[model samples]
Target: MIVITAPTGNIGRHLLPLLLESAPAHGEELRVVVRDPARLPDAVRARVEVVTGSHGDAGVVDRAFEGADAVFWLVPPDATLAPDDAYLGFTRPAAKALAVHGVGHVVAVSALGRGTPVADRAGLVTASLAMDDLLAGTGAAYRALASPSFFENLLEEADSIRENGVFTDVVDGDRRAPLVAVADLAAVAAGLLLDRSWTGTDSVPVLGPQDLSPHDLARIMTEQFGRPVHYARQPLDELYTTLVGHGLHEAFVQGIVDMKRAKDEGLDAGATRTPDTATPTTFAQWCARTLKPAVLS
Candidate 1:
C-alpha cells in the first residue's frame, strides 16, 4: 500500500492518476490523506482508500500508514504558522509513524541548497531540509525531491503580467536559477513511489531543462503572449511589508525574504543539471502551455 498526502495539491492532483493507472499492474493498494475528501475528483475518491484529516495529526497519519509500503509526503504551506511548526512540527509525527509502521519508502517534496552557506539562513529551504533530516532519521528509504522554484509560482502573478506586462520578485532579474514544473516533480515522485527496489536516504534534485533568470522568463512570456513583458525586482523591504500586511507570521516572512536574497546571491546556481536531474520541460514550453493560457484567462 502507498499513502499520499495533499492529494488535491498541484503535484498530488497530477500524481494521483499516474499512480491509479499503474496500481493495477503493480498490484499496489493506494491511500490518500486529505483535509477534505470532497476536494478530490470523483474518479480518485472512488478508487483509493481515503483518510480524511490533516496528515500532521498523529492519529490520521497512524491510520493512513497501516500496512503502507511507500508514501508520498508533502507539507502544505501555511504562512500564518511559524516555520518550525509548519514544517518540522507537522513532519515529526509522520516521521514517527513511518518508523513505527516500518514504511519502506518516503518520497517527500523538499527544496535545494542543502550544503551551501546560504542553506542555514535560507528560511523555507532550511526548514524543509530539516524536515528531510527528521525523515532520514526514521530509517525509511527516503528521497527528498530537492526542487527549486516552481514554474507554476509565476501563475500567481499572471493577472499582473496580463494587465501591466510585468511580474515581480525579490531576486535579481538577471540571476539564473533552476526551476522545475510541478508536473515534472510529480512524475519523478510517482516513479519513485511505484518502484520499491531503491533503499536508503538520498536527495533527488529535480532541475528543469535549463537554468533561467527572471529576465529569461520575461522574454519567454513576451514571446508567448506577443507582448513586451518585463521582470520587476521588488525591494526586499517592500516585499516584507506586504507579506506582514497579509498577516503572515514574522518569521515566515523573514524566511521568505532570506530565501529570495539567497537566490539573488546564486544559492541554486551550484548544482549542474545532468540527464538524470534535468526534467524534460523547459521554461519556454511551460510559458506557452501553462503561463500563457493562465494570463489569457
Candidate 2:
C-alpha cells in the first residue's frame, strides 16, 4: 500500500491522479489522508481508501501509515505558526507513525539550499531541511524534492498583471534562479513513491529546464499575454509588514523575509542542473499554459 498526505493540495492534487493511473498496475493500493473527503472527485473517492483528518494530527497519520509501504508527504503551509512548528512540528507525528508502522519509503516536498552558506539562516528553508532530517531519522528511505520557487507562485499576481501589467517579488529583477512547476515536482514525487528500490535519505533537486530571472519572466509573460508585462521588485521590509498586517504570525512573517533574503544571496544557486535534476517544463510553456489563462480569466 502507498499513502499520500494532503491529497487535495497543489502538489498532491497532481500526484494523486498519476498514482491512481500507475499504482494499480504495480499491484499497489492507494490511500489518502485528507481533511475533507468531498474535496476529492467522486471517481477518486471510489478508487482509494480515505482517512479523513489533518495529516499533522497524530491520530490521523497513525491511521494512514498503518499497512502502508510508501508515503508521499507534503506539508501544507501554516502561516499561523513559527517556521519550526510549521514544518518540523507538523511532521513529527507522521515521522513517529512512519517508524511505528515500518513504512519504508517517503518522498517529501522540500526547498533548495541544503548545504549552502545561507541555508542555516534561511528561515523557512532552514526549517524544511530540519524536517527532512526528522523524517530521515525515522529510518525510512526518504527523498526530499529539493525545489526552488514554483512557476505557479506567479498565479498569485494574476490580478496585478491583468490590471497593471506588473508582477512583484522580493528578488532582484536580474537575479537568476531555477524554478519548477508544481506539476513537475508532483511527477518527481510520484516516480519516487512508485519505485522504492532506492534507500537512504537524500534530496533530489527538481530544477526546471532553465534558470530565469524576474525580468526574464516579465519578458516571457509579455510575449505570452501579448501585453507589456513588467517586473516590480518589492522591498523585503514591505513584504514582512504586509504579511504580518494580514494577521500571519510575526515569526512566520520573519521567516518569509529571511527566505527571500537568502534567495537573493544565491541560496538556490547551489545546485547544478544536470539532466537528472532538470525537469521538462520551460517558463514560457508554463506562462502560456498556466499563467496566461489565469491572468486572462
Candidate 3:
C-alpha cells in the first residue's frame, strides 16, 4: 500500500493520479488520508481507500501506516496559526506513527535551503529542517524533496494581476529565484516513491528550469496573455506595514521579508546545480501551459 496525506491539495491532486498509476505491480492499493472524505472528488474516493482523519490523529496514522510500503508525507499550510508552529507540531505525530508501523520507505515535501544557516531566520525553512530531522531519526528510508518558491504561488494574486496589470513581491525586479511548477514537484515526489532506491536522508533540491526575475515573468505573461504584465517590487517597510494593515501577523510578514533577503542575495540561484543535461520545463512553457489558464480563470 502507498499512503498519501493531503491528497486533495493542488500538488496532491496531481500526485495522486501519478501515484496510482505507479502502484506496485502486485495489486498494491493507494490510500488517501483526508479530513473530510465526502469533500474529496468522486473519482478519487472511488479509486483509493479514504482514511478520514486529521494529521494529529494517532489512531488514523497507525491504521493507515499498516501494510503501507511507502508514504507521501505532506504538512498542509495552516493560515490560522504561525506557519512554523503548524508544521513543527505535526512532526512528533508523524514520527511516532512511522516508528510504530516500522514503515521503510518515505517521501516528504519540504522547502529548499532547509538545512542551511542563511535560511534559518526565514522561519518555515527552519521549521521544515527540524521536521526533516525528526523524520530522519525514525529509522525509515527517507527522501525529503526540498523545493524553492512554488510557481502556483502566483495564482493567489491572480485577481491583483488581472486588475492591476502587475505581480507583487518584495524581491527586486531583477532578482532571480527558482520557480517550480507543482506538477513537476509532484511528479518528482511520485517518481522517488516508486523507485525506492535512495535512502538515509537525501535532500533532493529541484531548481526548476531557471531562476526567474519579475521582469522575465512579466515578459512571459505578456506574450502568453497578450497584455502588459509588469513586476512591482513592494518596498520592505511599506510591504510590512501593508501586510499588518491587512491582518497578517507581524512575525509572519517578517518571515516573508526575510525570505526575500535570501532571494535578493541569490541563494536560490544555485538551482543550476541540477545538471544542464537534465530535462526541465522553461518559464515560457510554464506560462502558456500552466499559468495562462489559471490566470484567465
**Top TM-score prediction, candidate number:** 2
Candidate 2 lDDT, 1-297, residue by residue in tens: 999998999888899999999998899999999999999999999999999999999999999999999998888999999999999899999999999999999999999999999999999999999999999999889999999999999899999999999999999999999999999998988889888899998999999999999999999988888889999999999999899999999999999999999999999999999999999999998889988988999
Residue 131 in model 3: shift from native, Å?
1.1
By TM-score: ranked, best first: 2, 1, 3
lDDT of 3 by residue, 1-297 (tens): 788998888889889888777675646688889998987778768789888898767788888888888899998866455656667776678789899889998898887774355766766666777788888999999888778888788887788878888888878888777888888888888888777777687788877877778898898899889988888888888877887788877776666667667667665655445572123767788778877887787
Please report, as a residue range, the 10-residue window in candidate 3 with the lowest summed lDDT: 270-279
Taken over the whole model, the C-alpha lDDT of each candidate is: 0.92, 0.94, 0.79
Task: Please tell me which model should have the higher TM-score, number 1 or number 2.
Answer: 2
* Superposed Cα deviation of residue 139, candidate 2 (Å): 0.8
State the lDDT at 157 in candidate 2.
96
lDDT tens per residue, model 1, 1-297? 999999899999899989999988999989999999999888778899999999999999999998999999999998988888889999989999999999889999999898888899888888999999999999898999999999999999999998999999988788888999999999999899998789888999999998889999988888889889999889999999999999999999998998888878777877779999999988888888989889998
Query: What is the model-wide C-alpha lDDT for candidate 1?
Result: 0.92
* lDDT for 218 (candidate 1): 89
TM-score for each of the candidates: 0.98, 0.99, 0.91
Range of the 10 consecutive residues with the lowest summed lDDT in candidate 2: 186-195
Model 3 pairs whose backbones collide: none
- Over 4 Å off in model 2, which ranges? none
Supply the TM-score for candidate 1: 0.98
